[model samples]
Target: MTAMIKAHEIQGVIALENSFNRVGLDHVVLVKVATAGVVTRLMGGSREEVINALSNAWIDGQSLRTYRHAPNTGSRKSWAAGDATSRGVRLALIALKGEMGYPSALTARTWGFYDVLFRGNEFKFQRPYGSYVMENILFKISFPAEFHAQTAVECALQLHPRVKDRLEQIEKIEITTQESAIRIIDKKGPLYNPADRDHCIQYMTAIGLIFGELTAAHYEDSVAADPRIDVLRDKMTCIENPQYSRDYLDPSKRSISNAIQIFFKDGTSTERVEVEYPIGHRRRRKEGIPLLVKKFETNLARRFPAKQQKAVLDVFLDNRKLVGIPVNEFVDMFVI
Candidate 1:
């Protein structure tokens, strides 16, 4: 059902045609629009009501780009999607009560989403709303790092065994990645908070090399206080790979690639290791899904007794049982 919902969105009328970040808007605006349409229908609204709710979502959506990166990055990046979706539900509920929607919410000359937020550019679509995005959405199953830097972290982890014993002897660490990563996660200087640290490519790579793994715990102040992370970060350099950038934005390929190479003070260098795709890519679903399930079970086990955990895990593990259960009923099973 989640995949079904996402498919409906990515293939729907209003789709991600233009780059929201390039226009200074947060892409989560799409989430608000998409969620409004789905939630309105779920609440038994007619097609007209759903349209009204969706229009309102567009009219009300803010760019929220500041919360996504740099000096202003904070816990809000973690909650922005929830915020957008929640706002969508509220808008949909209001529209159900007869709140009107702007007929020209997207094209009203000076006051429309296109003119105001998109600089007069119309929304575009590559394909119809469908299950494709759901089938192909990237997941950060192997590391807690940002999706853009997932492969970089993997690349760094590969180089860890060689560099772990010679940290002080390393003179430089070069990381080459797609341009989107450089635009989104490349960071230097002091990171102010956990959100800031987790999103930094340099920070993620350094931690992966130093600790051999990156978990949520590694983003904490306690772990970050290890001076070696910043020391390594200072020695690291990040640049864009044109081929990677092209493949990342290509409609068909959509690969996220990163290569890490470390140079030692004694003029020795580690082999340059490149990871073209993170484990969670659709291309590697067979390899990724099991690990993703294990990750889910591990997190679930930390909260519940073994018997209860297995019971819950069993419900999820069985697709037939899981899909047949109502949403409310499934959620009730996790109630403390």
Candidate 2:
């Protein structure tokens, strides 16, 4: 799909000015819209059919707010984007079979998506579609936590060595993050499962500080049963730092900064540690890419023999060999 359009098209969607989540909608609707247009065109649909397919994508998108946020964050948050993409492909397939589309699906009177879903405001764009999103994509490199809280986990890891020996002596812990982190992951109270724990900033920080590292297993029930985690969560306070919030959305400096400080029961405190951009941020690409490659190598090594792993890694490590390969052929390399 990316190969079919100019990078600007992807950039345009990334730069969308409106917050769909703010209005009780999942941003994955963009995925559906993009997929529908691309799939329809790939299926040799007429221009009108492509438009119709996109309109249907909008009309069918679920707000999906509860699955990700609110009092019941769950596993569905991980599946929602895939569901949207599947629906888009299905809609495109249906459109290819001569199905009629609602010409005014988005603009129709009171029943339109604008009036019904968007509270009467039409969709708005921040820039023309481009590949900026592809180029600056946030990689959830080491931690399995939410993207906004990744830096917080790094901060916790940095503070882990000093705080490990004084867990019970700690009085309170302070976490400062951008507004988006507060909005998406500043969770409190009981977290029921891995899905919930992974999204909770306090849980991630607490576990990182105590364990000296965090992994998928840390969010599991067995690991979460450690009473020390809940103890730390109870003593933690999270707040929005306006500067971090401002810098987070800055186009030139898309930093996901987080700060952590701890006060002991005694009259002592750890030096306030702050990390501006996570290792996954584009700004850290030089340092991050090697780690990403190592991560890929590690995962591949776990699944395949060294010989097979080397064969697979060779294809991915070489840009010249990978550039013009057919998509099907590339995927077939991993068929085993």
Candidate 3:
């Protein structure tokens, strides 16, 4: 668990900057790099072997951001991280088997990753690897929407009761959000699939306002076929709040803030609803953990028998007991 946490820290810290995204590369490349480094170390690889595995990861081709953006968004964005992590493990094992690696895979002048993919700019870091990322990780406790749109969904849900019965009376909806949300999820036009819908702030907020809930199923075609969703979506105008954007990148705050207001055709408006820190934020950990545990139990109930659920929960719900169990033994608890 510590090793995995460290891996997450490595990836998350590097991802604090817009490094990979600025280069049009998907951040899952960090998953490959971080996983290779940590998993190689876990398998007892020597320093040289770890270095070789890391080099292999860097040399591995990265996925483009296209699959995560409009016009090409699809389920590939969902599985890209899994694919990258699998490749990471494969490279680590190969390196352990004595496969050679390029020493300059990232800096080999003309053909290196930096030159070829990053526009010749070196990767930047906000801080050294540590527990910061793990300590401050955000959970998607309430909605299956994109992280950038999490607070937006929350804001919409807050206003749901006021606007649910007056959908047609809404003349316009204004979404005030951070720059990151604007850059990534302020999508317009038709959303082709669940993947696209989940990434769109307007679509997510619409579902929250109309249904007073946002779930993974809300993004499906059946629910999306409702014309009111598009009606709300079309009425939405996303505007970036500079302060919100600044606070988002501020390490001290790291807020994902959003506000939503509805204007009625009769010239009246609902009070603007704003959410600064989402339920998943570290600041809201006290409120988030119980919900997270409930989500876990609900998911477990879907596949496991009562006895199996209890057995799994017995270990996971107790921190000391969970920590004492060997990784393989812990994994075996879930094996059928």
Candidates' TM-scores? 0.95, 0.94, 0.98
lDDT of 1 at 327: 86
lDDT at 256 for candidate 1? 91
lDDT of 2 at 179: 93
- Candidate 1 is scored at a TM of 0.95
Reference-based TM-score, model 2: 0.94
Q: Top TM-score: which candidate number?
A: 3
lDDT of 3 at 100: 82
In candidate 2, how many clashes are counted? 10
For model 2, how does the per-residue alpha-carbon lDDT over 179-296 read when each residue is reduced to its tens digit?
9898888888888878888889999999999999999999999999999999999999988899998898777788999999999989899999999988988989999999999999
Question: Would you list the rank order by TM-score, best first?
Answer: 3, 1, 2
Model 3 per-residue lDDT tens digits across residues 1-336 = 799798999899988974687678999999999999889999999999999999989888888999888988899998999999999999999989998888899898989988898888787888888899888989988888899999989999899999989999999999999988988898999899999898899999999999999888898899999999999899999999999999999988899999999999999999999999999999999999999999999999998899999999999999999999988898887887
lDDT of 1 by residue, 123-199 (tens): 87777766667667777799988898999999988888998999999999999999989989889899988999998
Cα RMSD of all models vs. native, in order, equals: 1.9, 2.0, 1.0
Off by over 4 Å in 1: 2-8, 11-16, 61-63
The model with the greater TM-score, 1 or 2, is: 1
Shift of residue 84 alpha carbon in model 1, Å: 1.1
Task: List runs of model 3 lying over 4 Å from the truth.
Answer: none
In order of listing, the candidates' clash counts read 6, 10, 0
Candidates sorted by lDDT, descending order?
Answer: 3, 1, 2
Best by lDDT: 3
